[model samples]
Target: MSTEGSVSNDREGHVKTEGERSFWGRLANWGLYQTLMTVITLSPRRQFFILAAFPILWLLTQHLGPMLQMLRVSLLDAYPVAPDVAQEFSLESYFKFFGDPIFWMPLFRTLIFAAVFTLCTLLITYPVAYFLARHVSRKNQMLLLLILLIPFWVGEIVRTYAIMILLGNTGALNLALKWLGLIDRPIPFMYTSFSMGLGMVYLTALYMLLPLYSALEKLPKSYNEAAADLGAGAWSRFRKITLPLTIEGISSGSTLVFLISTGFYATPVLLGGPSTTVFAETIAGFFHVAGDEWPTGAAFAVIMFIVALLITGVFQRLMKSLRKGESS
Candidate 1:
């Protein structure tokens, strides 16, 4: 009788354990389902805010956070300070940039180079974008774009290296010219302003191309057709209709390319000679040193950033006025 009683007790204990597990599992599921229903019942604006929380967090932490830290560092007298030393804030870092004239050439050159390169990119890519948007069948456009984007799939360093190989003395262009008897010797294409400019244009071409293509594609073909029907020539149609309408694309592409060109370090380093050194390299030189020079680099970076922004701001104003004039 005792043996049978113990067996019945074991069965009851097993059933009780299962009941406890089921109770907790149901509770967990209920809580989760209730939370989801609450979220679903939220207003659309609240839902949007919930969805946007991650991206806003990323922008704050990843983008704004680093810039703020850099600004703070720029104001400091030194970084990586002695463990017990107090921090000193000063403007001497900023003064160094103003006081030293050696940095002037690279700074000005970077601005000029960025502007020229951005314009060249615009001119070069505009035709290609126009053809892609206006001439090509819609079905093949994505395929063509994918083909064009193949070169950009690689990292910037790899692309810069490819440029180096292509522009080297005995590279394909030189060899082809030699084979054609066009030149007696290979021209030195590497380590020059021309090489740097070529690389900049190549790197920034996509930025210009996509915006122009978007603007061109979204443009109503009817506008140009109507102009043509009214006895407008091709150039006239483009000038009066296409160009005016596409000003936003030009502005956006130019701004993106100019800003990107100003900050390029790898392509310029690889393709540029001493005479072609840009402000970025100069700023990097400061950080490369062992000691308090880091603040100076940070300071110059801030200066370059501010100057670039001012130039773009002026460009934006001009573009906006042009847009207004075109619209009027």
Candidate 2:
């Protein structure tokens, strides 16, 4: 009887073990997850390609696809051609931009605004980035960065409205000035170039700050210390050592801010008066008109894109040369 009971107990233990294995095995072998696991285990290169496929496809479909479509439309005489009508392509849309002088001022204005705003953003954020990277403790650095980022978490429109509220006649700034007896009446800060510029700088500050901070953080403290030991003053060390080292960050941040500033429509419209209309606002006007005007808008957009790229290319070459000079 004892022998029989021991044999039965062994059989029961084997069944339980098999049951647990079967349950886990089913989960591991489920559908696409199993296929992915198999590829990952068998071929690392194949695994990488599989992982990268989605983003590559998304870029092709979402970004490149739209640009190509826009380019095609820009060459056409008219978009949304009737079923009975033959699709005719021409350079008229593009010609419209070059032939007219009315469009010139806004384009020039946009470029100038973008350049100024980019510089302002860089100047303002550099000190903050330096302080955070050099003075703040490592344990609390992330917390401070998070606090800075919280404002950007909201939509651009919301943030623009917040700026509107702050700069309006009866807003915080004016009220504060009045309270301090600096002015008897509220300053008309709204719908002006200053207000628009202020909004642009506020919006693009993060783009400049993060790159500067990243570059500053990766920089070795020993270099600054060594320079100081050699009797270099703070300004001398910063001008010679710190500035040269972080040129790449400055270029990256400036480029991003400039590109973003050129494309702003809503903020400029809301904050700017008639004199401050940007090329983006002009481009938007074309789109807001009849469908026939879409091709014109597309053409103008392409012109702006090409011009911006040309400017950016020149800027990048300058930055590259500067980097080479620093390294040498």
Model 2 error, position 83 (Å): 2.0
lDDT for 158 in candidate 2 is 87
Error of 2 at 64 (Å): 0.8
Tell me model 2's lDDT, rounded to 2 decimals: 0.90
Backbone clashes in candidate 1 total 0
TM-score of each: 0.85, 0.85
lDDT scores in order = 0.90, 0.90
**TM accuracy, model 2:** 0.85
Worst 10 residues of 2 by lDDT: 18-27
**Stretches of candidate 1 exceeding 4 Å from the true structure:** 1-28, 31-58
Runs off by more than 4 Å, candidate 2:
1-24, 27-57
Output the number of the TM-score-best candidate. 2
Worst 10 residues of 1 by lDDT: 19-28
